[model samples]
Target: MKSANDQATALLEFRLSAHRTLGPKERDLISHLSWRVEELPARQTFIHDGDKPAHSCLVLAGVVARTQYTAGGQRQILSVHIPGDMPDLQSLHIGRMDHDLETVSATQIAFIPHKDLNHLCAISQTLNATFWRESLIDAALHRAAIFRNAQLDADSRLAHFLCEMHFRHKAVGLVDEEGFSFPLSQELMGEVLGLTIVSINRSSQTLRSLDLIRMQKGHIQVLDVDGLVRFGQFDGTFLHQRFDHETLARAS
Candidate 1:
C-alpha cells in the first residue's frame, strides 16, 4: 500500500489538473476516498470493452490509452490520458464501458470504488459538479481529436497533438526547460492520429525538419513555440484550462 502522503499528493495533482481551486470541504472529501493501487506493465489491457467497472481508475504514473477495435481488427485510439486523470470516472454514470482502457507504459494506478464515489457525490454538490465538468471536458477533447483526424493534414495533425500534450503536461507541472516525457512511440502515434506508420513517420520528420519540435529519448522539446502553434492550428481555448493561452504559450 502506498503511504497517505503519496495518495494525498496524487489527489492534489488531480485537483490541480481538474480545477483551479478546491474548497476545504471538497479536499477533505477527496482525501477520504479509499483506493487500492496497482502496478501494471506496458501494453497491458486491464479494462476490456463492455465491462461494468466497479472502480474508476486514476493514473498515478505513466499514460493510459482509450482504444477501440474495428471488426476487421484495426485499432483506433480515442484518447491518451496522463497522470492525475481519472480516465474511467464516466463509468460511475455510464455503467458499461464502450472502449478498452490500456496502459501505454509501465503504469501505476489507484482504483477508487464506484460505491465511494457515488456516496461522496451524494452529499457534495460542488464536488459532483466538478466531476461533471471534467467528463464534459473529456468529451470535448474527443471531439477535437475527431476534427483533427477528419480535417487536418498528417503533419498538422501530429503537430496539434504535440502542442496539446505540451500544454496539458505543463498544466500538471510535468514540464521542464527540456520539455516533458512523451511516452507515445511512432507506432502508437500512428494509432492515435489515425494514420499509417509511413504517414506518421513522414509527419514526424516534417515537424522535426521544420525546427518545430525535437523528440528524443521519449521527450519532446519545443524549439519554436510560435511556429509549432501556427503549424498545428492549435488553440488552447477549448481545453478549458484555468490558465490563459498566453501563460501556456509562454510556458512552452
Candidate 2:
C-alpha cells in the first residue's frame, strides 16, 4: 500500500510513460504533483466523451481504455492503457474528451488537476518532455488501432492486441512466465478487434488450438512467441517504447 499523497505510483507511471529514463531531478517532480486515488469499478466511465475535465486520470493499477460509441450505441475501444499510464492526458489541451475513458478492470486511479500538472511541467524541463512524450505515444497507439481495424483480419487483430498487452505489461515490470493480468472481457475484446464477442472467443480458441496461446483464469500465456508474432503480423514498432527492448534485455 502507498501513502495517501500518491508519490510512488505517480512516479512509476511517469518513468515507464516514456522511452527516456527519469533522473533524480526529474523524479523530484513527483513530490510536486497533487492527486487523490479513486477506486472505480469495471465499466464505469470516469471521463465521458464530450465533457471537459478539470483533472487528468492516471492508471496506477488495473487496465483502462479510451472508448467511443457509434450512433447505434455500439462501443469501440481505441486503446488499452495499463498501469503507469495517464489515459486522459490530452484533455489538458483538448479540454473536452473526444472519447470515453472507462475501467476495464476494477481500477485504482490518481486524478491530478491540470493546474497542478502544468505548474510542475513549467518548472521542470525534463518533466515537461516526459509528459509530452507520453502524449505522443497516445497518438501513435490510436493510429495503430485505426489501422488495425481498417486493414487487419480477425486473427491478426487479436494477436496484435495480445502482443501489445504483453509488451505494455513488460514495460512496468508486470510480467512473469505464467503471464500478466488480463482483466479484459470477451465483450471488450470484441470492441477492440471489431468482432462479435463470439468471434473473439473463436479467435482465441483457434490461437490455442494452434499452440500460440493459452488464456485461463483472466491471464493469457503465449505458448509460442514466433508463431504468434507471425500470425498477428505484429511488428510492435508502433508502440514507440524503445526502452522496451532494454527492459527485455534486463529481464533476459
Candidate 3:
C-alpha cells in the first residue's frame, strides 16, 4: 500500500517538475499539500465534463489527456499531460471541469484538496504564482493548438507537437535530443492532430522514411533534429520553457 508520505513526495516532484522552480518556502508548502494516492487503469476518466471536483489530481506516473467532444460526437483532445501535470488545476477556482480528464496509460495520481490549496495560496504568494504560472502555460498550449490546428498541414502540426512535447519533457528531464517515450496510439494521435487515422499513419511513416525520426521500443528517437524542427515549423516560445533553463537542469 502506498502511504500518504509517498503521495506527498510525488506531489513535491510534480510541483518541482514545472518549467519554473519554486522557492524553499514553496517547496515546504508542497510537503503540506495533503494528497492521497490513487491508481487508475488506462482510459479511465478521472473527471468528466461539467463535473465539480473538490480536489486536483496530479500525475505521479503515466499520461493523461483533457478531451472535449463536439456536437457531432467527435472528440478533440485538448492537451496531453505527463507525470507532474495537473490536468484539472483550473478547477480549484472554476469548481466545474469544462472538459474530461482521462488517463492514456495506467496512472498513479495524487489528489490534493482544493480547499487546502486555496488556503495555502491565500497565505503564500509564491504558491499562488506557481499555480498561476501553470494555468498560464496551459492557456498558452491551447492558444498554440488553435493556431496550429487551423493553419498548419497535418504533418507540420504533428511535427510542431513533437517539438513542443520534447521541450516540455526536457524541462522535467523526461526526454533529450535522442527521443522520448510515446505511449499514444495512432488513433489518439489522429484525434489530437485533427487528422484521420490513415493520415496519421501515413504522416508518421513519411517522417520515419525521411529519417527525421526512428521509432524505437515505444520511444521516438529524433534523428534529424533540425530537419524535424523545420518540418514542424516549431517555435519554442509558446511553451514558456525559457523561463528557467538552470532550474530545468537542476530538476532533471
Candidate 4:
C-alpha cells in the first residue's frame, strides 16, 4: 500500500517539473489536497459510462484504461492512465462520464471530492491554472494517439506506442535498469492500438528482429534507443514532458 507521502510524491510528478523540486505555493496546494484512498483488484471498473461521479480518481499505482463499447458490446480501450494521472480530471467540469474507467492491474487510487477541488480552485488562481493546464495536456495526448493510429502502419504504430509509454513511465520515475514496467497484455494493447492480436504478435516480432526491444514477461526492455526512435518516427514533443527527449530515451 502507498502511504500519504507516496501519494503526494506521485501527485507532484504530474507534469510539474522534470527534476526540480516544487515551489512553496505548489507544495501548499499539494498539502491541501484531500483524498480517500482505495485499492482495487486487477480489471475492476472504477467509473462506468454515464455515471455522474462526485470525485475524480488519481492513480497512485498501476494503470487505468478509458474504454468505450459498441452496441454489440465490442470494447475499445480509448487510452491508458499511469501513476500520477487523474483520468477523470475533466469530470470536474463535465458532469457525466462518456466512457468507462477501469483498473488495468491491481491499482491504488486517491479519490478527491469535487467539492474539495472546487473549493481549492476558487481559493487559488494558481491551482485553477494548474488544473486547466493538465486538461490541455490531456487533450494533446489524445491528439497524439489519434495521429499514431491514423497515420502509422502496424509495426511503426506499435513502436510509437512503446516509445510513448517509455517516456511516460520515465516522466514519473518508473523506468529502471531493466526498463519500465508494462502490465497491459497484448490483447489490451491491441484494443488500445486498434490492431488485431495477430498483428500485435507480428509487430512485436518485427521489433525484436530489428533489435529494438526485448520483452520478458510483462516488462519491455528498449534496446538501441536511437534505432527504436527512428523506426517509430516518435516525437516526444506532443507529450509535453519536462524532461529532454534524449534524457528520456536512454535507459538507466
Query: Which candidate number has the best lDDT?
Result: 1
Candidates sorted on lDDT, descending: 1, 4, 2, 3
Each candidate structure's TM-score, on Cα atoms with residue i matched to residue i, is 0.92, 0.91, 0.89, 0.91
Model 2 worst lDDT run, 10 consecutive residues: 243-252
- Per-residue lDDT tens digits of candidate 3, residues 145-249? 888899999888888777777767766666765677877888888888899999988888888898888765457877887888899988778877644233323
Better of 2 and 3 by TM-score: 2
Worst 10 residues of 3 by lDDT: 243-252
Question: Cα lDDT for residue 83, model 4?
Answer: 79
Candidate 4 regions exceeding 4 Å error are 13-22, 244-252
Candidate 3 stretches with Cα past 4 Å from truth are 1-21, 176-178, 243-252
Residue 99, model 2, lDDT: 90
Candidate 1 residues lying further than 4 Å off, grouped into runs, are 1-5, 12-20, 244-252
Give per-residue CA lDDT, model 1, range 1-252, as digits (tens): 758446644554455435647777777777777678899999999999999999987887799999999999999899999976778889999999999999999988888789988887888887777888888888888888988889899999999999889887776667778988988888889999998889988998999999999897678888887899899998877788775332322322
Give me the candidate number with maximum TM-score: 1
Off by over 4 Å in 2: 4-18, 245-252
Clashing pairs in 2: none
Question: What is the alpha-carbon lDDT of model 2 when measured against the actual structure?
Answer: 0.79
lDDT of 4 by residue, 90-134 (tens): 999999999999999998888888998888779767767777777
Better of 1 and 3 by TM-score: 1
User: How far is 136's C-alpha from truth in model 2 (Å)?
Assistant: 0.6
